[model samples]
Target: MVIRTKFMFRAGVTVLALSFSAPALTHPHVFAEARLDVNTDSNGNVASLHHVWRFDDLFSSTVLVEFDKNQDLALDQSELEEVGNVVHASLADFNYFQLVTHDGKDVPMQAPERLIADFVDNQLIILFESAPDSPLPLSGKVEFGVYDPTFYTAIDFVEDSYMTVNNLPAGCSSSVVRPDPDEALAQNQQSLTDAFFNDPTGNDMSKIFATRLELTCSKDS
Candidate 1:
């Protein structure tokens, strides 16, 4: 099933700068540029959809999962085997060590190279790529709810941090704050608002410094 959602916010500034002690991280910021597009059908009822997702991780996975088999059922040796009989380079036979190392899979890296997870629409999307190989920012599909962990969990085996309410700037509109600890994420959507654009220049971003951000995590991890 294809999950349809719109991730409520985006960063205006580079966030990687937040983690000073965490060396495993390099690109901590999230950037997205959506091409607002309109689709026309037989009756001329204009439908709008942004070919959205400045997902550096998602973009790269596409390159990998492109090797998938089973008619898009999943990515595995069977997919790679389609191109060859021996199937030397397949998902199952992949070297996780190499994948993690290449993708910076730790403090430096947030998500795994390959993943499949339950989205807000509660659907699983097969991630086929990693980060952007080119200089340009990466992007993909458009989402509709607010759940970094929900989206990140599939690709990221472990969640270190994300766009959280604790760090939210001013001008952000929502029921509350977002990108908080996993346990605390199960609250009202009001914690997160539909105000932030893909740009980092959110209206309420300054709140990060002013607010006490109600978060739930070990103070000293």
Candidate 2:
């Protein structure tokens, strides 16, 4: 059965564009499990961000119905490619749902050249690599997080092993930071006003609940 609920794709195929009341704006209509790998260059500078996102079954089923042109009940390679293309194009409007910073300054990321989509266990998986517009030297502190600023989709790093640093330099360590929901809400109450929900591109209030990855490298290293 084709699910014809209120779900609408905007930021990406996995994201839902809901027109719900302000009280319901905080709740996500879609969900995804994400795995991130920070790849470093030979000089130990961050080169690119690799992502593997597995969408929830309900959203995946909706995608299959929309993109499975043959009505064969299974997505073929070409069908999957079509899904990937749509997601890659749509995600650009939302910075691919990536948040990267160096020493508290925002780091710009280039659009991914391509995205690979696959279906497994009734879920849709997307894989892509996003590189910084310029090389980001591994110094001081670097932070990364995946989130839907509009709060239409909830992306979670469900496992400790889901976040990793590859080719990390010596004397550097990485850790995950899961914010306290109550504390975050209390601190950002003003930013979460009704205006925030109405404006999609308004201040990013989602950061308060984002699960972030922090990387610290010793200057001597």
Overlapping backbone residue pairs in candidate 2 total 0
Tens digit of lDDT per residue, candidate 2, span 54-130? 98998899888877778899899999998788777767766888989899898999999999999999999999999
What C-alpha lDDT values do all the predictions have?
A: 0.24, 0.80
TM-score attained by model 1: 0.18
Candidate 2: give the clashing pairs: none
lDDT of 2 at 97: 84
Per-candidate TM-score against the hidden true structure? 0.18, 0.85
Candidate 1 local accuracy as lDDT? 0.24
lDDT of 1 by residue, 1-221 (tens): 01112222235421111111111212223322212122222322212211222234453344234344335545455443332222112223222111111111211112234333212221212322222122211111111111121111112212122222222122222231224544333453354444332322223221222111122222121
Give the per-residue Cα lDDT of candidate 1 at 19.
Answer: 12
Error of 2 at 83 (Å): 0.7
